[model samples]
Target: MKQRHEVFFKQLEGMRNYLLKVADVTEEEAQIVPKGFKNNIRWNLGHVFVEQYAWIENLTKEEVDFPKHFNEWFGWGTSPDDFTAETPSLEELKPLLKEQIANIKGTYGDRLEEVFEPTQGMDTLEQVLLWTTFHEGMHLQTILDIKKVYECLIEN
Candidate 1:
């Protein structure tokens, strides 16, 4: 189990680096909804952080480390239209995503032996983190797609 956790930690480093690359967009670009997409780059970026925090904190029944009322803006079904307060800028979202990766690694790296029961077919913290890296990768791909569309918009 410890070795498995160690492997995922390295995988997470790749995720962290990919997310940072996805986040390199202007605030305006982040909010632009390309014609075929329902969400903007900004929304997807924040969603990644929201998911990591929600899965870990919810399962552990521990206090989440995100900003105040983050779920209101970034939860699974929440969207920019649902936001009642100011959301973080692209600049702000990037670092928060980066910080969450560090928090997860720092807090759990040595403790993967700690077991939590299966919820949604994930039987342990390591399983959740493992799945989350793939989840974040999907969103990073979405961000990249959005950027490609944004580029088309720019070229036009």
Candidate 2:
């Protein structure tokens, strides 16, 4: 792997670890849609997982493996209120998130600079991966906010 690609992978792994740490709440807490929030910790977790796969699929034109119903449960514009079935718990999601960086590196580490027809204005796999990282960061902030709300609620 190139040095830059190694750095990118390490950054991704670090960010994912931090996100998992921030999500250290009970399953019940993960399900709590704090007042004024559109979704809960669980929803944000699932969305990040699904969104990464969706972006990679768009770039590679290849299907990526993820749990069934993840798209319906967590896709963009989806809400927990719309879920028709039970979704993965934090326990399930954490392992998937932990493994995702390794999988991404193994699958695309050497292909980062490879160019493809533009998707969402991104022509390189690296560009799409950067965008996905930004997307994950945004949802990580949401999870932190939700965690704060849950903590306050418990204190009250």
What TM-score would every model get versus the actual structure? 0.89, 0.95
- Give the per-residue lDDT digits (tens) of candidate 1, residues 15-84: 7887888678788888887787878888898888888878887566677666757778877887768755
Range of the 10 consecutive residues with the lowest summed lDDT in candidate 1: 109-118
Candidate 2 ranges beyond 4 A from true positions: none
> Would you list the clashing residue pairs of candidate 2?
none
- lDDT of candidate 2 over 63-128, digit per residue (tens): 887774788888999988876646777788889988998998998899999998899999998999
For model 1, what is the alpha-carbon lDDT of residue 128? 80
How far is each candidate from the true structure, as Cα RMSD in Å?
1.9, 1.2
How many residue pairs clash in all the candidates, one count each? 0, 0
- Please give the TM-score that candidate 2 achieves against the real structure: 0.95
